[model samples]
Target: MKVCFVGSSGGHLMHLYMLKRFWADKERFWVTFDKEDARSLLGEEKMYSCYFPSNRNIKNLIKNTFVAAKVLKNEKPDVIISSGAAVAVPFFYIGKLLGAKLIYIEVFDRIDKSTLTGKLVYPITDKFIVQWEEQKTVYPKAINLGSIF
Candidate 1:
């Protein structure tokens, strides 16, 4: 299956990277920030950069929505996954419309509450995962996958 892994530059990106076992053998690419760390870690991977400072940033959100349309159209990944900040919103929405399965892994840290991105995408996500069992209270339908670390 083809996968599109999308997230922000730091821990969110790291969370997705931890799924290498699942993605390594698949046809996959990434959508993340074009920061130094992402550049270094995904040096040899197919990647697309997205607009950042995405939290509450209308302009970047609009820009990333366009980026999402273009990339998801081009890649046509069968699945899209993220442990996100805010960047994943646009991609998940468009990917769902494009008939790609969406998986949103709630960050390992947020134990009982939801992140903004998680809350925004939960209704549309095909699989919503949480690292802590306690988080199930907030995302009742979420599967408890434990830490991807």
Candidate 2:
């Protein structure tokens, strides 16, 4: 199965990167911004770029959306697993429209509630996971996958 890991920098990428071992034998790829931390975490052979800026700017958002749409068209992954900040929004939407499963893993920091993306994509997501049990009250459908750490 082809899998695409989509997320932003720091904690989001770190959590998603941990899943790499499970897909070591399958087709796998990742999408992240041009941040140094994100670039360092990406493997030389299995990564793609999306021009998402850390700050919220209209230009960057539009550029990232276009880049995301193109990547989804080209990769045509079977599923997309995401630990979102913001970039996951476009990736998930496009992947979903293309008939791909969208799996969302809420950020580890979200102890009491779901992240914005988690809430936005909840109904459409094939699977929703939460690391914190406390988040269950907020996202009743979220599966408790424990911590990805």
Candidate 3:
């Protein structure tokens, strides 16, 4: 199976990296911003870099959509999994267009409420995994997969 992982730089990347255990037997690549954390975490793997836009900016979002479209066309993954903070938006959308299964894993930091990315992308996911059960009420379709830590 071919899997593509996407996320932003810090905690999102950390949460996604923990999923390495699940993809150990499959082929995988990554899409993330060029940051110290991403460089360190995904250095040994095939990674595609993109500009991580600020959550409040609209212009950057347009650019991200274009970048994501390119990545989706190029990688052609069977499935795309994300532990997100905004960057997951375009990737998952493009993954859907390519007929890939989309998996959204809510970050571990969100203990009480659902995050902006989690709420936005939840409906589009084939499987939604949350670390906190408290979030299940907000996103009832999500599965409690326990904490990534």
Candidate 4:
């Protein structure tokens, strides 16, 4: 199955990268920022660079949404998975609309409360996973799959 992995840079991307073994054997591509870490880690991988200043940036959000639409249209992945910050928001929404299964993993941080991306994508995601049991209280429908780290 074709998979589209979407996440922001830093910890969000790290969390997703931890699952390399899971997607290693699958046909996959990535949606992330064009940052140093992303470039270094995903050097040989297929990727689509998302816009920066994504969170709360209405302009970039709209721009990235359009870009995400094109990526989704071209990739046509069966599953779209993310450990988010902001970039995943547009991708998840557009992927769902395009009939792709959405899987969202709440980041390893934020044990106290749900993140904005988590709250927004919860209703639409086909599978919602949380690292902490406390997060399950915030996302009752989410499965506690332990830490991705």
| Highest TM-score model number | 1
Candidate 2 C-alpha lDDT tens digits along 17-113: 7887877788888888777897777747478877666345668667777977899899989999998877888888888999999899988887986
User: Which tens-of-lDDT digit does each residue in 2-61 have in candidate 1?
Assistant: 999999998999989988888889999999999999999998999999998999899999
Distance from true location, Cα of 25 in model 1, Å: 0.3
Candidate 4's C-alpha lDDT?
0.92
TM-score of 4: 0.98
Task: Report the CA-based lDDT of candidate 2 relative to the real structure.
Answer: 0.83
In model 1, how many backbone clashes occur? 0
Give RMSD to native, each candidate: 0.6, 1.6, 1.2, 0.7
- Judging by TM-score, tell me the better candidate of 1 and 4: 1
- Ranking of candidates on lDDT, top first: 1, 4, 3, 2
Ten residues in sequence with the least summed lDDT for candidate 2? 52-61
**For residues 55-77, what per-residue lDDT tens digits would candidate 3 score against the true structure?**
75678777888988988898799
Name the candidate, 1 or 2, with the larger lDDT value: 1
lDDT of every model, 2 decimals = 0.94, 0.83, 0.85, 0.92
TM-scores for all candidates? 0.98, 0.91, 0.94, 0.98
> Per-residue CA lDDT of candidate 4, range 1-149, in tens?
99999998888888888898999999999999999999998989999999987888999999999999999999999999998988999999999899999999998878979899998999999999998999988999999999876
